[model samples]
Target chain A: MNEPQFALRIRQHLNQGARVDARVAAQLRAAREQALARHRSEPEAGLALASNALGRLGGVRGLSLRVLLPLVILGVAFATAVAWQQTQRVAEVEELDAQLLSSDLPIDAYLDQGFAAWLKRRASQ
Target chain B: MAEAARLAIALAAALLLLAAPPAAAAPEKDRRWSELNAEQQEILVPLEGEWDRLEPAQRVKWIGVAKRYPKMTPVGQKRVQTRMKKWVKLTPEQRKQARENYRRISKVPPEKRGDLQRDWAEYQSLPPQERQRTAPKKKPVTAQ
Candidate 1:
């Protein structure tokens, strides 16, 4: 048969098939709706077949470390600041110690407040 | 190979988390006198007798001092060693006062410093009664 004749015959058969029993058509319509709903939902529903949202985040590590990272960073930053402050204080002390240790001024001469009073008196003289 | 790389990354992350706190906690961490490098040990030798007795923070400070030692003039180095010997014997109150004196003295002009130091020496040589007369009057001693 020629192509148009073949197409016309197929269309006629489809039209006749369309005139189905009401109950059967209703069943077919319900099935088609169900299939359409599933197809529309395929992408989202596919994930459920694998695992939940939490599990897909590479399991426990992702969950724990994501939560753990910010907390640990905060703790470390605070601790490091404290350590750096203490280090700065120590450096100040060290510089002072090096200075005082190497200076020509005697410790007794340095420490005597009366000596300062006496020096002022001598200077005024 | 990919699995191994992932595991290594995860392990490294865990280790980084574990190590960070201890590294930050080093302010109070102690190092033995012997743990000091040769230069530190040699420069810090004067403190050896007191090393084990010193606080961790104090040891850290002394190590810092030692690190700067090589740059000092020979006389300055000798003076440091000599004064450090005496320095360790001072009470905390005396040390505090000495530091106060240093802060004030350092601000004096270089030329006047010698004169000031000489005056201090002369002032100290005065008889006790002479110094008493020269010194600003203190609050009268109360009967115990």
Candidate 2:
């Protein structure tokens, strides 16, 4: 019989309320456990790119989404962070240099903070 | 199949990392000392010795100053050149300190700025030993 009919027969057999010996009951429970294990995975979900990649490759056996998802996420985040940091560094240097070059105060005025403090003290006194 | 996907992702990430260096470095490579215009090379002469050693952003900033060089007053232009010459000689830590000092001083009132300038002149007039005594407290420049 096809799978549906076979399943129906097994269901009916179990519902018959017949008493079974210890060995047969244990064997049935083990078979059900194996069946449940086979059905452990849900349908593939999330991130069309990731899912599509696996789908196209006929899906990898036993590769958990739990691990793969985080790997993709962390890689993307870290790369983005690195690129942003470099750009900021370049821009900051450019603006600071432009301002320093354009300002009226002699660069020496800028080179020493203690001199500025001295100027402040001189002004106060 | 999922394993292949992981491999593909890793390869793609590797490619992205590989791609970043070329983009950042390509512009720097293009800014070789030989590539600068005659005027730029002249205006930035002070940097010539260390031009290649400078970061790409440094070279770009100096080039900008050269472009604006003609518009500035003679004194302004001279000041920029003098400042740049001294700037290139500074260690990175000293540069950081200079930047902090500049930012702080820029905020002083315009009327009071004259006083600060006069004090600066007086400070410069001090003997070498006196100037050394007045040196700013040394603070290590931490990377931002």
Q: In candidate 2 chain B, what residue range of length 10 has the lowest lDDT sum?
A: B21-30
User: Which tens-of-lDDT digit does each residue in B10-116 have in candidate 2?
Assistant: 77677766666645532222377889989888888878888999877667767755766787778767777777878877888988888888776666555654665
Top lDDT prediction, candidate number: 1
User: Cα deviation of A99 in candidate 2 (Å)?
Assistant: 2.1
TM-score of chain B of 1: 0.65
Per-residue CA lDDT of model 1 for A51-121, tens digit only, reads 44545565643344434445555676566556666766776778898977777776777777677555544
The digit string of per-residue lDDT tens for model 1 on B32-137 reads 9878878777887888888888867667777777767888889889888877767777787888888876776666555543475576777778888887764445
Off by over 4 Å in 2: A1-70, A122-125, B1-30, B37-39, B53-75, B125-144
The alpha-carbon deviation from the true structure for residue A7 of candidate 1, after best TM-score superposition, in angstroms, is 55
Docking class of 1: acceptable
